[model samples]
Target: MGGPDSLTKDTAHDVASHRIASVEGENGGGKEDAKDNALQALSTFLRDDMEACNREIVARMQSPVPLIPQLGAHLVAAGGKRLRPLLTLAAARLCGYEPSPERQRHVGLAACVEFIHTATLLHDDVVDESTLRRGLASANAVFGNKASVLVGDFLFARSFQLMTADGSLKVMAILSAASATIAEGEVLQMATQNDLSTPIERYLEVIHGKTAALFAAACRVGAVVAGRPEAEEAALEAYGTNLGMAFQLVDDALDYAADQQVLGKTVGDDMREGKITLPVLAAYQAGNEEDRAFWLRVIETGEQHDEDLPHALDLIARTGAIQTTLERAQSYARAAMQALDIFPESEIRQLLMDAASYTVSRVN
Candidate 1:
């Protein structure tokens, strides 16, 4: 890898090209900086390694079958934060791994992490019937669902190939377990869908499997690759897990938010799909008798009409569900920050801290 000077310049350009619009005069720019630094700062510090990882991702996504690479490239071009692989790379660096042949191995592993995430996204769009992803047409929307599913299987196979090349039982075990958890979580979410009776603990279990499992695995693999001690590995896993919990909780709340631009999709999509998120659960749990009847008619019976969304929003507001959800997210972010106590203070650690804050900052 190049020195810090070259890395800083390259990564800043990458950040500027992909960053969200900065919030003007918001919290004296503290909030804006926190959001920007979520990915930008980490990319700056890991520029060279990330570039290598990006190259591997692109190269591996190719196939002679035109449909496979075509859909894969379409998703690659669609802008996402690419945060999963970034976490993998950043964790490696935070644990004192530097640019070397051994460190270079992490590049492919990071790409493997990205492949796993992308594969899940493809499958999720088909399952959720989601039309949009990152403000662009989703793979399942553009490609047929059958094609998307097959291509997703291809990506998963590719990820497993990368894992095998690493030849570390620990890495293999972690990634494989994460993959199983993600599948299990999706099934559990589907099973719980539209049932307002779903408990908060069950909801937490679903997200932990679907979202936080991979986040923990991503960070753990970084430590495993670096041959870090078990204590440091566990800390990174804790940090990633809590950060992921915060991220998903905010995402669930945003489904019913009024601001569509920030979400890049229609508000109340979860409600429309009859997905039982935290805010919905909160409102339903606290509702009056009439409110309960209305919710049962809409959610359980799937009898929702166009006017139902506004009433749902009203109920959510009366219950202060969004605020309660945000508070829960903040608690997780604090826990994620505490997980970093074992590491000595560094710019990388600070960026990670800010990233956790940024996860919950979407509500602002």
Candidate 2:
């Protein structure tokens, strides 16, 4: 939960400390403020489209089973930034797609994207045994794991219904493939959990399948609906993939470095769960024998004590793992920005680029 300054003192990694400071300072008021401004700008730009998407989301989530709607509304009302759905809507608009009364494919598809994301959150909470989400009690905690899992299944079914109604096999193919890849990623994560020896390449595979696939699918669907060229579709997909990577890397760093109040969930939850992230890998790779033994006891053997988290944080900070993680995230953010260069200059394009910058800048 400590900031860079709190974590950096008395450490020999001066260069990494300075790099962290410089990156945070470059965002002006703060990374959190910068991210807030970026999200607000995107939301305002896509207000009408988002409203339609919300309506579609509500309508599709309804069912005769009262518990379904109740559970779905609880999660929806928790009010995440809706970044996935927003990506779909924004990417569509950026490709010159407009919604009409008779044809609002983007809106429905945006809602569909949200359904998939929300379903994953429900399932993930159950799997991670998570109690909090978006600074509120998670659905699994409130509704029981059984209900949470069932509701997640319901949402997945609903997403497919929306996709089928869109009547585009290409759209269906992209989303369905993403859904499968997400499942595979979760399985892969489970396989690698509590194992300190998991390689960086394997970790990248996990994140790409779990997070980036949907991001890429969401953006590519936009180009598909607009009947854009394959080149443009590939470009947007690349942008989304890189942005998702940056976003997840920042999230991992924040688990070790962010204020708990700002982070919404418990700090070090990943460490507590013995999940091997980039920070852990970086720190372990740089640590000596004693440090390696410590990681083995806590992470591999699942034997943690009251002071273990602080020690882990110290190790991560002293090794400059958080800074290293953030720097890698910055590279992905830059790649995401470059992917958009093929598109001509426009307000939407700029907003998309800002969104990519915000992916790395966000502290929460």
Candidate 3:
């Protein structure tokens, strides 16, 4: 495996641009279509397994209470990329595990990963007072915060049931610990909200727990199910962790820069909500005294006006915060690609590499 230094910025950009162009050529579409081309490719490659996993997800989401499934189905229909579960399935396959009647644990576990993610989205939307999710009305908006919270709890319970059904103490321990860490991450984010003085280390810790923990657990369980060696498990965990960090960093950048139509959510939601993400942090760190005062007014004091978002964007742009954040994401994506060096060359492995590239390319 190469070190992070092995993949320079130019190299990462060239590789990702080439991969994006390849997908665009194949699909006869533009760069817009290329954003999710890796996910589409992985979905096509794992169509059968993903179908089975979807079935398991639908089945487990059911409840006697009508609203449980209704709210769950609404979220499912909104069509998130399901990246974590895909990681689980892809990792299992990369480890040479095939689903069978007696050995179908991966499928259920994949569904379990989705359940956990969905539950988090529900709770997060409620906490953030978000009205939109994936360009659709948020569950909390449509179903009410109480209903969304209760249904999220229901999904968490269902996820646990699937974990118990898997009958692997190791799997249960991995996922359960991730769940706890996710909660702590959310709380930590809350603690840091509206506080511009939050350190970079604390911000990294929050994202590691909030986003990367489940990603690591999801990939690790795939190796566990395949009974692969501990080294392989650790490799996949590293890949997922770095991939997740890259993903979140790009997401934060997009919050300020992306087109709402393309981003599938309102731009500047983080800024409006006083969340101090990497872009904000970097901009604040680099800004002059007046710039610091601006961030203090809009973010720290939460006195944002309708025109404040544009000024914030200008500040971030002038300080090159968005570019810096994306570069940081590229480094993580490079590390993620290097992590997969332990695996032998194969179609699945190449697609996994492309997926890491896609994580950084998303901001392009």
RMSD of each: 7.3, 11.0, 10.8
lDDT of 3 at 219: 92
Q: TM-score for model 1? A: 0.89
Per-residue lDDT of 115 in model 2: 93
Model 2 lDDT per residue over 124-216, tens place:
999999989988889887778998999899999999999999999999999999999999999999999999899998998999988999999
| Candidate 3 global lDDT | 0.86
- Model 2 spans with C-alpha error above 4 angstroms: 1-36
| Candidate 1 residue lDDT tens string, 1-364 | 1112222333433332332122111212343454465666666566667667776876787776766666765665565677899899989888887667654768888989988998999999898899888777777777779988999999999999999998888899999999999999999999999899999999999999899999999988888888899999999999999999999999988887748766776788788788888998888888899999988888888898889999999899998998888899899999999999999999888988888988898642
Against the reference, the lDDT scores of all candidates come to: 0.81, 0.85, 0.86
Candidate 3 per-residue lDDT over residues 104-145, each given as its tens digit: 999999999989988999999999999889888887877789
- The runs of at least 3 residues in candidate 1 whose Cα sits more than 4 Å from the true structure, single-residue gaps closed, are 1-36, 101-103
Candidate 2's C-alpha lDDT?
Answer: 0.85
Clashing pairs in 3: none
Per-candidate clashes, comma-separated: 0, 0, 0
